[model samples]
Target: MADGKNWRRAGYVGAGAAGLLAGNLALVTGSIVRAAGRTPAAVDDGPDPLLIDPPQLMRSTVAPTGDGTLLHVETSLDLDEHPSDTVLVLVHGWTCSTRFWNPQVNQLAQHWPVIAYDHRGHGLSEMGEKKVSVAMLGQDLEAVLTSTLPAGKRAVLVGHSMGGMAIMSWAAQFGANMADRVAAVVLTSTTARDVVQQQLLTPPTLPRYTEMVKPLVARAFVAAPVPLPSNELTSRLTHYMALGRHARAAHVEFTDELISRGSPRSRAAWGAAMYRLDVAAGLHALSVPTSVVVGSDDLLTPPLHADYMAQVLDHNGVLRDYVTYGGAGHMVPIERSEPYNVLLDDVLKAA
Candidate 1:
């Protein structure tokens, strides 16, 4: 009888703790939303970038890979346009599809041939028998490079978040082939390593007591197969976690929907993979001109990560410029596309 009472008491305590966390999270979300109302004139008054649909239809095809993982590649330009020249390749981050690069693909395709691909198991693509890791991401990128780019053609690779990490992985693993195929590289809202330790959404103070606390919460967040249905709680939490001080309601919803679209198992697998990420060697192997962009309000891979990259890139003479948008967050590409596109255009011009 005493044992039963102890078990019941522990269950009640757990329930009470969860309830408390939920209530506090709600209040914090409200505070963040209210603060976001007073955004800067630059990001505040513009037409929503996320609403910018692709004016040109992108033809989709399966990019060839040696490992047999299916990578869905979308192209807006004719295959014959730049068979031997440089093309703009946009690689999306975790839980995002080729649609994530709609703003870039639409605008850049007018002059430059543009390509964006879905990561394995993220969108229309299927995960093959190979395990998911940063190294595999690199190999998959190489597959896309060889399959999509005709012989003699090079690409200006633009990778966002995990996509950027994949680029780093490529450079580290296939340094011998880096200069032969890639013209230049653009990394935005991403990190080379230690992604879990730098998350702003997870409080750093809690780790003072136990370092395990933060990773435990982060694992629960990325690995949990919770439907994350569109509701007040999910919306607010998404906004707080990713968007900046000036994020619009629509931006939050768009990002949330994309994240929730991934299957539970895929999300869990990739999320766990990030925890083991160690691609510092990849970042150091970058021999081509590389530009790093980050948002000041990015809660995931914060500016500290960018600063670290700048140090390494500068040392190697690969640094172009380190840019930080004051009011932007992790969704810098969507939240601040006009200026972001300008930066991309500059890279293309120099390349």
Candidate 2:
């Protein structure tokens, strides 16, 4: 009887020790995040005139998710202008809306028909059921494509960050139809795997510490009690994580507005999905002609991701071109719009 009682006491002690260790790790991570928050952001001298305005000639439509959710889709047609055979579909990243592609719409809409849409729980879209996953995002893309594009029309698909991931998920589920519907694909600043493991935000020397802190960071991204506001700290963090160091103040502000407007629940839900993201094998199914673009200074989805994607696409005999912007960050679409636009135009024309 005494031995059994001692064993039970030992079990209690072991559980208590584990709880205490976890509590200490959480406290440490909290302190690090707070320290990062206190750092000041560098301000740019002036705003770029080109980025000051939003897109015009946009028509909004709603596409049902078939699961009681409605997505907000914006289509720009050059009916009396330089209309072309190919349609350009733009997908924005996490914490962003269709407005995130305003610059691209402004440049591309005058030539080809352009379609941009907000993900579930973003922008003018209504949030459906609470469950969110990458598969759901893929389904959303499929619905938007089916509802927006005409029959027998093919599209040149462009996606940034999580938007790029959505394209992969879509290809995975609907690869057979992709050859007929998708003319080409452009993946910008995205990865297929090792997102958490290969992140550059945390230092390499502290692997164990980073592993402990990753879950906390993911939680904060989705649903922090006191959410990070549109302040200097938030701006600084956005600039660091998403934009280039040479990014203009106007660009940073533009990016921050879209990010801050995101729904916390949606953000958290999608963030949890990102934690388990692994669509590397799905790349094999993406048999369409493809292009990859990345920023040299991109801390989120660094150049290594671009390299791996290029290699995989090439091995599959589907690579078209791989381009890297020097000193650019994850927000390559906005940071280097002139060249990025030109590159996109070239891809569209080639397709």
Query: lDDT by residue for model 2 over 1-351, one digit each (tens)?
Result: 999999999999999978866775666555545544653454577775546445466777899886969999988754224347688999999888887887787787777888899988778888787588878878899999988876667789899988998888888887786778999999999988766556666434444634665655545544452444687767777877677767678888888877888887677777777777887766777888999999998888999999999999999999999999997889899888889999889988888
Question: Given candidate 2, what's the lDDT at residue 45?
Answer: 71
Per-residue lDDT of model 1, residues 95-134, tens digit only: 8888788777767777787878988988988887777887
- Give residue 169's error in model 2 in angstroms: 0.7
Score each candidate by Cα lDDT: 0.80, 0.80
Q: What is the lDDT of candidate 1?
A: 0.80
| Candidate 1 residue 140 C-alpha distance from true site, Å | 0.7
